[model samples]
Target: MATPLWLAGCVAAPKPSVQATLPPAPPPTLAPVEVEPAAPATQPASLFTLITQGPVSAMLSYSEKVRSLNGNELNAELARLGEPGDVPTAQMQTALALAQTRVPADLARAVGLLQRVAANTSAEARPLHPLARMLAARYLEQRRIEDDRDRQVAQLRDAQRRIDQLNDRIEALRAIERSFARPANGAAAAPASNGAKPAP
Candidate 1:
């Protein structure tokens, strides 16, 4: 009887409580990425500014050399630049022309050179330089004015010729009228001579 009681107590021992396991923590939070903004684009310099202040040609470096050059040196360089068959002749000419205009005395020469450059270009293809364009416009305007003057002169000549023809026609008509009048007068005199008189 004592052994049964002890066995019963051993079998009835309370089952241990089952504790639920917690899930693992999520991955560590990442700091937000700090992306830099893109840089803005820069604008290219103007053709006028480049020609006047910078080198017009890669073959000849005018920017730095021009700064150091005196008036004489600049003049000599301009003479060299003006020669025919120079490499990149158009650009060199433009640069030299721009430089020449800096001197008060040489401004006229610069305008002349610019005029030449402008004349060479057509409406379909124009120079990038502002001075070059202005020069071309001046050339075209001068030509247009000359053409208008010539046209007016031709018109005047034609009008004078027409007036002369009209005057000749009027004189011819007057002569015909005078001739007819004489015939009528002769007929009237002949009627009178034939003794046919108008009854009053």
Candidate 2:
């Protein structure tokens, strides 16, 4: 135990700590821009040439791209066409005919646009721009077809209404006739005054 003190003195002593100080960083500087001298103003584009030309086409075409969405594709469809279709493409195309009439269809607008184009274009240009003329013609034909369908429907409704009115009139007349047939005071028809037993 007495020899341990000498052994401890031979061990190395701990080192002192050292502190270093540095200056704060300066603010960042921006680079200067080199702008060129002023130049003459540019002329505006001529829109007269465009306006003199025919009206633009308004045909809205559907896409073949599949909307691969889950839970709903409706939000996507509205973004494309301002509304959604009642049926998906598969059922829509496969249907023999639609049960309900298509509404807010832009076909009339397209037809009108095409017609204006055709009317304004030169006679020689008609051949070159045959698509526009054809579009107007197609829309006119469709309008005629719709007109015919509406006329048929109106005729059918009118016939049905007429039949109903006729039935009402017949019932009223039948009631009047029955009223006349009933005798006064619940009495039956009186026997012949002469008691005409003589007649065979």
Candidate 3:
């Protein structure tokens, strides 16, 4: 039997579609940006070290007082120590010496004590606390400069005295020469040793 045109189209197989199902796309990868690190900050000079020392029994009492004492209290403590001229214990020396610097009147004495402490301290041992040898060195340098200046002033004074003496001697010699050149006491002029008369 012959089929109709519409029926033949319906029976024909459908053509395959060009579009295809695809898997989901993954996230894009990004390159990481590099940054330079900042430089470390510089520390200012200070007498105290940041390192904490283990508690020393000898320094325990004084160290506590130094940390908490006011100006008046510090003065009193120093006065008490001054009565017998008691030497400070080694453990408390640095802290006590540093505390002394706070008193204007005690500045020189404090620096001297620090110098002695620095001298006695062994560098290989634990570092000095609350006091640096640099402070002692600076004080000594100032003293040396002052001494040198005093010597220079003395030398300059001596030089000035010698110059004045030489000037006075020169003046005296000039006066003597002038007097010798002039006829004295209205004396008559000396006759010429030669008998020959001077020609006009």
Instruction: Name the top lDDT candidate.
Output: 1
TM-score of each predicted structure versus truth: 0.35, 0.40, 0.38
Sequence-dependent TM-score of model 3:
0.38
Of the two candidates 1 and 2, the one with more favorable TM-score, higher being better, is: 2
lDDT per residue, candidate 1, 1-200, as tens digits?
Answer: 99999999889768899999999999999999999543322322233344445433321344445546777777776676565332233443544444433543354444555555545555422433454556446545555666788799999999999999999999999999999899878976887688876779
Segments of candidate 2 deviating more than 4 angstroms: 1-106, 117-128, 189-200
For model 1, the stretches where C-alpha displacement exceeds 4 angstroms are: 1-130, 190-200
Clashing pairs in 3: none
Q: Report the C-alpha lDDT of model 2 over 1-200, residue by residue, as the tens digit.
A: 85799889888888797777778888888789889533323321112221334212211111122223322453344344432222222122111011112322444544544555555445533442455566457666876788789899999999999999999999999999889878653443344454645446
lDDT on C-alpha atoms for all candidate structures: 0.57, 0.46, 0.54
Put down candidate 3 lDDT per residue, 108-144, tens digits, no spaces.
Answer: 5656665555555455223443343654566556556
> Among all windows of ten consecutive residues in candidate 1, which has the lowest summed lDDT?
38-47
Mark the regions of model 3 whose C-alpha exceeds 4 Å error after superposition: 1-111, 119-132, 184-200
**How many angstroms is residue 92 displaced in model 1 relative to the true structure, after the best TM-score fit?**
11
Worst 10 residues of 3 by lDDT: 43-52
